[model samples]
Target chain A: MLKSAKMVMERARELAAKRRPVVAIAGAEDDDVLRAVSEAVRAGIVGATLVGQEVRIHALLEELGEDRNSFEIVNAENPKAVIALSVELCSSGRAQILMKGKVSTPDLMKAVLSPRAGLKVGKLLSHCAVLEATGYHKLLSITDGGVLSNPDFNDKLAIVENAVHVSRVIGVAEPKVGLLGVMNEPDPDFPSTIEAAAVARSCYVKGMTKYIEGPLTMGTIFRQMPEGATWKSDVVGDADILVAHSIEEANIAVKALINLRGAIFMGVITGAKVPLSLVSRADPPENKLASLALAAVISGASK
Target chain B: MTFQELQTRAQHIRPARMDVVGATPFEISIIEKWEKRGWKVRYREGELEHCLQAAVDAAACGETDLLFCSGADNLKLIRFLDRAVSRDYKPLTMLQGFEVPSYPKVLWVGFTPMARYDSIPDAIKGVSVVAKSMAELGEPEARIALLSCVELISPGVHSTIWEATLAHMSQRGQFGKARVDGPLAFDLAVSPQAVSNKGFKSEIHGQADVVIPPDLNSFCTLTDEIHLTGPHTAVGIVVGGPCPIALPPHRDERHMTLSLQVASLLV
Candidate 1:
C-alpha cells in the first residue's frame, strides 16, 4: 500500500518506533553509513552497534559533531573479525539487523555465508532493490540483481519468495510477482522464456497462483496493459515484484530505472535470518537511510 | 497506386523535378512513364566517373531538385550527392509484403554501409530523419519501434541498451514529431495479437511506421528474410539530406519507378 519511497520511510519509522530493532553495522567506519545510522537513531527508528576500530569510530562520531558515548562501538582487529562479531551479535539476539558498511560485498558475504557463524536460514540469499519513481503508481521491487548470477528454477522461486516477504513487511498483503522474460510465449530458442514458463507453472502448482504471473516484459509491468487482451493477470502494469531470470537482466533494469528514470531506491540482501542492508558505494546518503529504514521494518516484522 | 495517382499525391506536397543519372535503358523507360503523367523528368547520360558532375549540373540548372541514382553500386555518386545536399544522410528502406496478409508495410532501415549507425545517438539520428520523412510522405505522427530481441535492457545485450536509450531520448523530446517505443521484438513490433497478448502499452505497438533495428547485421538479416522467403516488394530511400535519393535493390523498371514515386514526396 506504500505508493512512494516517502511512504516507505514513514511506515518504517512507525514500525521501528513500535519494535525498536537493534542494527549491527559491520566495518562501520564509513561516514555515509554513520550519517544514516545517526539519523535513524535520532528518529528513534533503531539503535546501532558499530563494529570497527574504536579510534576511527570515535573520530567519525566527533567529526559528525555527535557525542562519543551516544552509540555502542565494538573494537575489532580486521575486516573478517568485524563481520564475524556483527553476525554474532545478530545471531545471539543482541541485534536484529546486520548491515555492510565500508567492507567489500564479497568479504561480508563470506562471513554471512560461513556455516559456523552465518545468518543463513536454509534459503538462498538474494538481493532485492525497492524503487519508487515518479510515474509509477506504487513502489516496485526488483530482485536477485546483485547476488545470484544465473538463477535456475529453484533460485528464482526463492528470490520471488524473499521479495514477497519484504513486500509483505512493507505493508503489501499479497505482492503480485512478474517473472520477467522477453516475450509471453515459450520459445525453444530462448531459455529464459522456458524458465519463465516453468516458474509460472511452479507458482501455479504450488497454489501461489494469485501471487505471480509471467513471462512478462518490463513495459507490461510499468506501462498500461495492452488494450482488449484476453489474458488475465493482476501483475501486469501493477506488479509489486519483478523476478528477473539472471543477474545481468535484473542489474541492467534496476540501474536503468535508477540512472535514467530518476527513481529513488533502497537495496537489501534478503532470504537471510534477518534482512541485510547492502548498498552500492555510489549510493547517496538518502538511499542508505532508506535502506536502514527498510532493514528496520523488515527486521521488526520478522520478530 | 498508379504513376498518375502518385504524381497527384506528390503535387499536394511539392512539385517534384527529378534528374536521373547512370541508369539503364529500362530504368529510363520507367521515368518516361512518369513523364507521361506530367512529371518533369530529365535523364543525364553519365558513366561512373561522370555521376557527380551530372548531379551538380542538374542542381545548378535549378530545374531538378531530386537526384535518382541507378543502384547502390554507385557509392561514389551517392556519397557525392549526400555531401552536396546535407551532412547527415540516412538511408530508409520500406519493406512491403502482400503475401503475408496480417502486416503489410514495415520500414526496415539503416542497412546500407553508407547508413551504418551503431551508437545510440547515431541510431536516434537515423530514426528521427526516417520518421520525419515518413511524416512528410503523408503518414503524420509516425510510430517508430526500435527493434531488439526483447523489451528489457539487459547487460551484454547492446541492442536493448541502445533501444532503451533511444526510447528515453524520444520521451525527452529528442526525436521530433515521432511517437517512439522500443526494445520491442519483431512480433510485438508488428503483430497486434502479440502486442495484445503480451500486454504492452505503446504508441508504436502493433502499428509501427518505421522499424529501426539495432545494427547493420540484424537489419540485413531481417531484410533478406522478408525478401527471399516471402513474396514482397522492398525499396530503399536515403533521406536526411536536402533531397531524397532512392536506393532501389535492382535496376529494374518497377523498382526504379517505385523509388522515384517515393523520392518525389521528399523532393
Candidate 2:
C-alpha cells in the first residue's frame, strides 16, 4: 500500500532527522522553486545544493529564515551548465538525487540521459505519476506523461513493466493495471482500439502485468465500476493509474485531473538504475514536496 | 455425411484438439483421462503458469499432437503462440463451446462478458442463478448469461441460466464444459412450433441445446412448456475441463459415477 503524499513527506522528514537528504536542486530560479527549496531545507528533507544564480538564492534563503552558510550554492552560469554540474554532483556521489528546479523538464531530462552529463543505463525511461484520487481507497499511478508519445504495443509492455516496478516501490505487490482507451472491447474497424485491446489481453496472458483492462471508456471508470471492488479490464473503475494511449492523451488526462478532477500528482522517472524526480511549474505545492521526498526515499531505499 | 461434414455444416464451429492447460482439480482430471486413452496430453499445474510452453515442448518432443484450454486463456497464449507459430511452431487450436468460433454466427455467454456487462448487475445475477442451480444439480460450469432477442448483447436472463450452468459445471468438476446457448429466437432454437405453425424448415429447429426466452417470465414459461408439451430430456455436462461438474440426474446414479470415471481418465 502506498502511503498518502502527506505520509510520504512525513516519513521523509523522519528519515531526514536521522540523516539529511543531499538534494541537488538544478536551475533554482523560479519563486515556486525557491519556496520548495526553502520548505525542503526547513523540513530537513534536503541538505541542499542550490545550483544556478547564487545571489538570488541567498537573498531568498535569508527571507525564509534559512541561512546561506547551512548549504552550498553552485553558481552555474547557464541551464546546460547547471544540468552538467547537477549530474556531475550526483554521479560523483556529492548528491543523493537530482531535483529539477526552474529548468525545463526535457532539458534536465536530456542532461540526465546524456552520455557525459546524465545518468543513462540504456533501457527505456518513462514517467510514472503516483496519484491520490479523492474518493478512491488507494494511491493510483499513470505513466508516460513525462516521456514517450504514441508507444507501440511493445513499448506499452515496457511501460507497464516499469510502472509495476514503481508500484512495488510504492508498496503494491500486484497492482491492477487498466489500459485506457475509448472502449473496452475493440470495434473491428478501429485499428488502434483493437490494438489496445490486444495489448491488454497480451499482458494478461503473458502474466507480465497483474490485472488489466482495455479500450475502457470513462463511463465505466467513474460511474459504473462496482464500489469497493477491483475489476479486471473493461473499465476498471477509478483505477490506480490511467495509462494513456499517447503522451498527448497522458498530458491531457493529467492536466484534467489537476484542472478538473482535483487530484494531487507526484511524478517520477522509472526504468533507470536510479529513480529521478521531475517536477513541473504547474504542480501544486504539495505535489512538488511529495516528489522530492519520494525521490529521497527511492534513492536511499537501495543504499 | 461424415462427422466432419456434419461438424462443418453446423452453424456453430469449435476448434478441435482442445488443449486443457492450467491446473485446477478439473483440468488435472481432464488431462488424466485423455492421456489414459493414449491420446497425447500435456499439462502444467501451478500459479500463472504456462501450459502453452509445455504444450509446444510436448509437440516438439512428439509427446502430444494437440493443445486445448478454455478460450479465456487465448489472449495470454496468443502472443507466444503467434511467435511460436510464426517460427514454424505447429499451429494450435482455440477451443470454443456453444459458439460458432467466428463472429456474427456465434455469441459467447457466461462470465466472459462481465467486462462488457458492468452496468447491468441483473445480468450478473442471472448468471449467478444459473451457476447456483446447476451446482445444486452437480456440475462444473461457467455461469451462462442469456441474451434477449438481441443477438449479441447479454440480457438479464443470462445470469439465471449462468448460475444454473455454473452449478452444473462445478458439480461435474469441469470449468468450461456446460453447453449453454440461448435467447435464441424460438424459431431458430427449439421446436420452431411458432414458426412451423406459420410453415417453414427452420435452420435450428429441434436442434437447439439451450433456448433463452426474452425475460424471466418467458424463460419460466418456456421451460414448463417444453417439459409439458413434448418428450424432452436434458443431459448437460461441463466439457472444457476434466470432471463434468453436474447435478446428478434423478434417474441415473450412474451419471455422476460415469462422470467421475471420465474425469479420472482426464488426469
Candidate 3:
C-alpha cells in the first residue's frame, strides 16, 4: 500500500518509468503548467502533448530556456478548442491522462462531461484529494470535495467505487473506506448518519471496496481507537479513503489539512474514462507535478 | 449518599429555592436527604398537571428558582415551560463519568436533540449553552467537542456543517469561556492515544470537558447504550432556562440523588 503522498508519487514514477503514459494538457499556455510538464518529462514520469496556441507555447518554452522540439505541441484557436482537442487525444488513446491548464474549472469539467467528447464513463464524476500530512502514517484520500455538492445514497456508492478504483490503481490491495459522520453511532435525526448507515450496510453485498464503516469520525481514521469503544474493526485507525458525506465537508477538511496542518496534497477527478489531473490555480508547481503523477498511476492501473 | 457528605460537596452552592411537584416515596426519600443537609424543599402532591400548575404558581409568586418534577417521563412539560418562560430551553443530558474509565471527569451535553431549532443551529446553541453552564459549575474553562460522524461538512450532512459553523464561532469568541472544537467524533474528543496516533494537534483532543451530540435521537440511543451495556451512570437536566430543572432518569434513589446533585451544581 502507498502509505504517504510521497510514496504515491514514487509509485507513479516507478510505473511511468516502466511504461511512460502520455498526458495531454488543455490550455497549456500557462507557465506553471509548462513548468510542471517539463519537470514530469525530465523525471520520465510522463510524455506530454501540449494542446493550446502553438505560437505562445513555443514562445514560453523558449523563454523558459527549453527546446521547443523536446515535446509535441498541438495548435488550437481558443480554450474551448484546446479542451476539445485534448479530450480527443485521450479518447483516441493517444494520451492516457488529461491535464488542466489555464482553463476555468467549470470549462474544463464541461468539456470532460460533454456527451460529444465521449470522455464520460457512465460513472459519477467526482473529485478525490490525496493528502500526506506530518502525523498520518499513510496517504489519505478524501472524495467529492470539488464536485457533487449533495451526493445521495447511490452517489455515495459511486464515489466509493471511484475512490476504490483510484486506490487499486495505486497498488492498494484492499482499501478501507470510512463513511464519515458526526459520531460513530447512527442517528435518524441527522439524515447523513442514516445515509452513512445505509451505505455501510450495503457495502457487505456491494463488495466494491474491501472494508467500509460508517458514522466514523476523523478520530477513528487518524487517531488511535479510544478505550471502551464497543465497535471494533480494522477500519478504525487504518482507513485509506474517507468517504465524506458532502462536498462542503470534504472541501473544508481537505483545505484545513493543507492550510492549517501544512499537508501536501494532489487532487484528481475520477470516474472518467481516463483520470483527469485537476490542480487548482493556487496550487504550487510541485502539487501540479504530483497531480500529473497521480493521473499517470491511475491511467496505468486502468489499463 | 449521606447528609454530611452532601453538605460538604454542596457547600459551594447556595441555599437554592426549589419546588418539588408530584413526588413519589422514592423522590421524597431523596428530597429528605437534601433537607437533612439544610436545604429547603417545597412539596406539591399530584400528577403532571398538578406539577405544572404548581410550577406556574411558584414562578408567578417568585418562590422558586429551580423546579423538580418526579415521574415526568416525556419532555412535554419542559417544552411547555420553555414556551411559557419564553427562553429557549435546551435539554442537556450529561454522562456522569468518562467514556474511558481512566479519563478525568467531563460534561457531555446535547444528547437530547433540540426540538426548537432545526438540527444544526439547535445543536450549536445547545452545545454553547451547556459549555457555558459547565463553566459556571467551576470548570472555569470548558473544552467542548461538537460531535458528528466526521469532522468535515457535507451539504446533505447538515449537522457537520453546523458543527463547523459552531467551531468557527467559538474561534471568533462567540461562545464565552468555552473552547469549542467540532465536528469531532467520540474518540477524537476524548482519546489522547487516538489524538497522538492520528498526529492531530487539538486542545480538546482527549481532554474534552463536554461532548455535544448532533441530535436528540442519537443522544437517547447513546444514553441507553451506556446505561444498559456499561457500568457508568448517566444523568440529565434541562438548562438554558430561567433556572436549572431536574429531570431524573428514573424515580429510583440513585437517579434522584444524581438529579439533585446535578441541580445543586447548577445552583
Candidate 4:
C-alpha cells in the first residue's frame, strides 16, 4: 500500500514520465494557481489548459517567469464561462483532470454538478483528501469535506464508495472505512450513529469495500476492544478512510492535520467521469503539486 | 489542564459527597479509594435507567455534590440527565480536557450534541452555554474558537453561518467573558503558523483554550482521531446542568477513573 504522500508523488512523477495527463484549471488567473500548474507543467507531471482572463493569465505567467506557450489558455472573463469551459475540457476527454483555481468551492461545484457539465457518473460527487500526517503509520483519507454539505444515508454510502475508489487508486487494496459518529452505539435519537450502523450493514452485503465500521470515534478506532464486545469494529485505530458525516467535519479535520501536524494532503473530487483537484489558494506549493500528482495517478491508472 | 493536574485542582476544594449509580466490583474499589481520601461516596444499584434516575433525583435534591456512573447507555444517561436537570437542553456541554504531548498546554473542548434544539438559534444558544461553562473552568478569559471548515461565511455551509454569528455575538460579550472567534478551521484555531500562513488576523492566535466543534458527532470523530495519531491522556466531564454528570468513558479504566476525578472539581 502507498504509505506516504511522498510515495504517491514519486509514483505520479514516474507515471507522468510514461504518459503525462492534462489538467484543466477553471479561473486560472491567480498566482498560486498558476504557480502550482506551472510547476507541474515544468516537472512534466501533467499538461495544462488554463481558462480565465487571457491577458491577465499571460501577465501573471510572465511575472512568475513562465512561458505562456507552455499551456493552452482560454480567454473567458466571466466566472461562469471559465468554469463551464474547464468542465467541458474534461467532459470532452481533452483533459484527464479538472482543477479548481481562483474559484469559490460553491461556484465550481455548481458548474460541475450542473446537468450540462456531464461530470457526474450517475451518482454523487464527493471530495476525498488523502493525508499523511506525522505520528500516523499510514495515509488516511477524509471524505466529503469539500463537497456534499450534509449527506444523507444514501449520500453517505455513495461518499464512502467514492472514498473507497480513491483509497484503491492510492494503493489501499482493502480499504478499512470508518464511518465517523458521536458514539459506537446507534441511538435512535442520534440519527448519525444509526446511519453509520446502517451503512456498515449495507457495505457488508455489497462487499465492495472490506472492513467497514461505523459510529466509531477517533479514540475507539485506535484502541483495542475488549474480548467479545457487542460493538467492535476492526477498523479501530487502523482506518484507511474516514467517512465523515458532514462536509464541514471532514474539511475541518483534514485542515486540522494540515495546519497542526504539517500533514501532507492531496485532495481530489471523485464520482465524476474525470478526477478533480480542488487545491486551496492557501495551500503551499508542495501540497498543490501533490494534489496534481494524485489526480495524474488516478486518471492514469483509470486509463 | 492535564488529567493529573485536574486531579490536583480538585484537591484545592474540599472533598464532596459523590453518588455512584452503577458499577462493577472494580469500579466500587475505585469509589472506596475515593472514600478513604475524604470523599463521602454513596452507592446505588438497580436497573440502569432506575439507578440513573435515582442518582439524578438525589443530585437534584442536593443529596450529592458529585455524580458518576457506569453501565447505563451513554446517550441514555446524558438524555436522562439533560431532561432531569437542564430542563430544555440550553447546553449540557461535554467538557473534554486533553493533555496532548505535541501541545503546549492542556486543551479544553465542548462538544454539545446532547440534546435536540428547535432551530439554528436554539443550537447556537446551546453551544454558547458550553462556552460559558468552559469560561468558568480554567482560563478566566477563555479563548474559545467556534470550529468550522472555513473562515469565510458561505450560505451553503450552515456551520459557517452559525460560527460567524456566534463570533459576532462573542464580540458583543454574548458568550460570557470568553474571547470567542470562529469560522476558523481547526488548524487556524490551534496553529499559530497556520494563522500566519493564511494571514488570517484574529484573536485566537493558534492558542484557543476551548474549541467548540460545529457538531457533537465531529467532536467524537476528531477526539478519537487525535487519540489515534497522537495518544493523549484526556478527561471528560459534563457541565451546565443541575449538577456535574460525569459519563463513564468508553476508553480504558484509567480515563474512566480520571473522568470521575475531574468531575469532582466541577462540583
Candidate 5:
C-alpha cells in the first residue's frame, strides 16, 4: 500500500541501493528533465545517461550547481535520433529504463516500437499512472490514460496485468483491481463494457488475480460501504487500483483527482521488455520527479 | 395488457418519444400502444448487437426525444446506455433500489450464484425496516413491507458460499434493512405448495417482490420467464452507475422503443 509518496520513494531508494537501474534520458532539451534526473541520482534511485546534446545537459547541470562529471553524457543529434539512440541503449542492456525528456510521445514510442533499436516482447504497449492521494491511505494506480484510447476487454486485461506488476513491485502483495463502470452489470447492448468486467472477474476466479469487481463508479469505490447491509468486497473503502473503461474517463478522472483532490501522480509504460517513463508536458516538477522515481523502482523489480 | 389500455396508461406519463431494439412480442405491443397515443416510436431488430453504435448515432443525431432500449443482452448494452445518459447536460441516474408503495415488507432472497450482496449495510437495512415499517403503520396510504434476505441454490458444495458471503456483507453493513434467508431452492421460492412440501413456514414463502438470483444466468432466465409467461408486464431500468438507463420491456420491440425514448428523458 502506498501510505505516502515518501514511502514509495523510500522503497525506490532501497531498490536502487541494491543495484541501480541504468536509465537513458532521451530528448534532453529542457531543464525540468535534467533537474529530475539530478534528484533521482542524488536519491540513489537511478543512474542517468543523457542521450541528447551533451553541452545543454552540462550547462543545465552547471546552472543547478551540480557536478556535471557525475552523470554520463552521450552526444547525439535531435530529439528523434536521441530517442532512437536511447532505444538502442535499452536493447543492448546499456540501460534498463527509458525516460522521456522534451520529445513528444509519438517520437518516443516510434523508437520504442521500432524493429531495430526497440525492445518488444509481443505485448501491447500501455500506460499506468500511479497516484498517492492525501485523502486516502494507500497509493492508487490508474491505467491507459496516456495510451490506448479505448481498449477492449482483452486490452483491459493487459492493462490490469501491467498495473498489478507495478503494485507488486511497489509492495502491494495482492492488489484489488476495480473495473470502473457506473453500474454493476453490463447493458446487453454495450458489449465492450460487460466484456471488460467479465474478463477481470474471470481472471480473479481463475487465480490469475487476487481481486476484481466492477460496474463500479469512482464514487462507489471511494465511498464507504452502507451502514446496515450485509455485503463486503476486498476493495471496499480502500482500493489500490482503479481501472477506467476508457482513456477519456481515465484522463478526466486522473486530472480531477490530482487537481481537485490534491493527489500526487506519476506514470510509467509497461508490457515492454523495459519500463519507459512517459511524463506529461503539463506535469509540474514534483510529478516529473515522482515518475522518474517510479521508473527506477520498475527498472529494479522488472529485472 | 391490451395495446389500447397500455397506450392510455403511457399517455398518463406523456412520454416525449420512443425507441426499441431486440424487442419481444410484448415489448412491440407496448410500442404500438404508445404510437396510438401519438407518441413517435422507433423499432429496430438485433439492436443489442449494435447498441453502442446505435446509441452514439441517437445521441449525435438527436432524432428521438427519449431513447429506451429493450431486448436481449441488456447487460451487454449497459455501456451504451451509460454513454447515452452522460453525453448530455442532464445526466441519467442509476438507482440502487426500487420504491414499492404497497409492500411494507421486502424479502431479499439471494440466489447462491450471485455474490453482489455478501454484506448488507446495517444502516441501509435499518433504514429500510425503520422507514417502511413506520410509514406502513402511521400513514393511511402506507403499506406494510417486510424486507428479508435469502439465498438460492448453486451447482456444487460452494453451497455454503452465499451464506458466508451474505453473512459477511451483513456483518460489514453493505445493504439496507432486510431479513436474509437462504440456500433456498428455486421450487420452494416460487410455489407455496413447494414451500409446504418442504415443511417451511415463512412470511416470504409465497409473496416476494424481488428475488436476487444466484448469478447472471438465473437472473436472465427468471426475468425472461416472468416476461414471457407471467400475466403482469415486466419493466427493468438500470441504476447504480454513472447514470440511469431506462431499459424497455425485455423482448417487446414496441415497448423497447418507448423505453429507450424514456431513457432519453433522463439522458
Candidate 6:
C-alpha cells in the first residue's frame, strides 16, 4: 500500500522511466493548465500532447519558459473540436491519460462520454478525492464528491468499486471501505443510513472489497470510534476509503479537511476507458500536479 | 452575549417555574443547581413520553416558563413538542450555541435532525428561526451565513443557489437589522484569515454569529466532527414557540445546565 501522496509521485516517475504515459490536455489554452502539465512532464512522469488552439498553446508555453519541442501540439479552434480530438487521442491509444484544461466540467465530460468517439466504458463514472491530512498516517480517499449527487444502492456500489480501483492504482492491494452515515446501525427513520448498511453488506457478501462496513460515521472512519461497539469497529481509524452518503456530504468533509486540517488534495474521475484529471482552477499548482501524477500513474499502470 | 454572559444574565432574571421531564439524578442535580440560584424548579417522574406530554402541556399553557427534557429519541421529543405547541404557536427550529476555546464569540448554528431543506423557502424558514433567536439573545444585527461547501453560486449545486438568493434578499432589510450572506465555506464563515486570504467581499467577513448548514447530513457531519475532536461546550434549544425548549447538545447533563439557564429567560 502507498504510505503517502509523495509515493504516488515517485511511482509515476518510475513508471515513466520504463514507459512514460502520454497525457493529452483538452482546451490547453489556459496558463495555469500549461504550467501544471509542464511540471509533470519536467518531472519525467508523463509525455505531453497539447490539443487546443495551437497558437495560444505555443504562447502560453513560451511565457512559461517551456520548450515547444517537448509536446506534440494539435490545433482545434473550437471547444467542441478541442475536446473531441483529446478524447480521440485516448481512445486510439495515442494517449493514455486525459487532462482537462481551462474547460468547464460539463463541456469536457460531454466529449469524454461521447457515444462514438468517447472514453466511457460500461461502468458508471465517479469521482475519488484523495487526501493526505497533516496528522494521518496514510492517504484516505473520499468518493463521489464531484459526481453522483444522490446515489442509489447500485450507484453507491459502483462508486465504491471505482474508488477501490483508484486505491489499487496507488499500490493498495486491498482497501478497507467504510460507508459513512450518522449512525452505525440502520435507522428506519433515516433511509440513507439503511442504504449505506445495505451497500456495505452487499459488498461484504460479494467480497467486493477488502473490508466493507457501515452506517459508520466520520468519527469511526477518520477519527475516534465509540467504545463497546458491536458493529464492525475494525475499520475504525484504519479505513482506506469513505463512501459518502451524498455528494454534498462528501464535499463538505473534503473541504473541512482542506480548510481545517491542511490536507494535501488530489482528485480523479474514474470508471472510464482511461482515467481523467479534471483539475480545478481553484487548486494550487502543486495540487493540480498531484492530480496529473495520479492520473498518469493510473493510466500508465492500466496499459 | 457569550455563553458565560448569557448564563450570568439568566441568573438575575426573576425566579420562574421550570418543569423537568424524565429526571435522572444527573438531570435532577442540574435542576437543583438552578434552584439554588433563586429559580423555582420542579421535577416530574414518569415514562419519558408521559412526562414530556405533561411538561409540554404545562409550558405551552404558561404554567411553566422552561421545560427540561431528555430522551434517546430526539425525533419523538420534537414531534410531541411541536404538536402540543403548534396548537397555539408556530413551528420551531433548533438553534445551538457553541463556545469554542479559540473562537471569539458564541457561534449560533441552526439545523434539524428531521428537517431536510432542499428548496429556498424551506431554507429561509430555518434561518429565520435561528436569526430570531439571535435577536432575542441581544444580537439585533447578527451576521448569519448560509453555510455551503463553496462560495460560488452554481446552477447545478442546489444549496449554493438557495444560499445566494437568501444572501441577496438580505440586502433589502428582509431579515430586519441582520446581515445575512453566504454560500460561505466553513473556513470563510469562521476564520477571518480565510476571508482576507480569499479576497472576496462579503457582508459577514468570517465573524459570523450564526451559520445555517444546507441540510441535515452536513449538519450532523460537521457538528459531530467538531464536537468529537475538539474541547468545547454547547448549549441548544428550540425557538419560535410559546416557550424556548431546552435541548442539550451532549448526552451528559452538565451541558444541559447552560441550556436550561439560557432558555429560562428567553421564554
Per-model TM against the reference: 0.57, 0.49, 0.59, 0.87, 0.53, 0.85
Evaluate residue A77 in candidate 5 and report its C-alpha lDDT on the 0 to 100 scale: 74
lDDT of 4 at A67: 89
Per-residue alpha-carbon lDDT of candidate 6 for residues A82-114, written as tens digits (9 for 90 to 100): 888898999999999988886777888777777
Whole-model lDDT, model 2: 0.52
Report lDDT (Cα) of residue A8, candidate 5. Answer: 72
Clashes of each: 0, 85, 15, 6, 106, 0
Could you give the C-alpha RMSD of every candidate to the true structure, in order shown? 15.7, 22.4, 10.7, 3.3, 22.2, 3.7
Q: What DockQ results for candidate 2?
A: 0.01
lDDT of each: 0.69, 0.52, 0.71, 0.79, 0.58, 0.79
- Please identify model 2 stretches exceeding 4 Å from their true place: A17-19, A63-65, A201-207, A222-238, B1-267
DockQ of each: 0.03, 0.01, 0.05, 0.47, 0.02, 0.33
Worst 10 residues of 6 chain A by lDDT: A224-233
The sequence of per-residue lDDT tens digits that candidate 1 reaches over residues B55-147 is 655565665777777633433445555445433443433332112223455444443334545555556667777667766766657787877
On residues A79-128, what C-alpha lDDT tens digit does candidate 3 reach at each position? Answer: 87898899999889999999888787678888888888788994779989
Over 4 Å off, model 1: B1-267
Of 3 and 6, the candidate ahead on TM-score is: 6
The best candidate in terms of DockQ: 4
Residue range B117-209, candidate 3, lDDT tens digits:
345566565766677677656665788887664555655556677778878888888888788888775556766655665567676976787
Interface RMSD of each: 16.1, 24.7, 12.2, 2.2, 22.6, 3.2
Candidate 5 segments exceeding 4 Å error: A189-192, A225-232, B1-267
Give the lDDT ranking, best first: 6, 4, 3, 1, 5, 2
In Å, candidate 2's interface RMSD is: 24.7
**Candidate 3, TM-score vs. the true structure?**
0.59
Residue B197 shift from truth in candidate 1, angstroms: 43
lDDT of 3 at B256: 67
The sequence of per-residue lDDT tens digits that candidate 2 reaches over residues B172-206 is 54423444443333323332342344343333343
Chain B TM-scores, listed for every candidate in order, come to 0.80, 0.31, 0.83, 0.90, 0.46, 0.90
* Candidate 3, chain A: TM-score against the reference: 0.93
Residue A88 Cα positional deviation in candidate 6, in Å, after optimal superposition = 2.1
- Candidate 4 CAPRI grade: acceptable
Chain A TM-score of candidate 1 vs. true chain A:
0.94
Task: Give the higher-DockQ candidate: 2 or 6.
Answer: 6
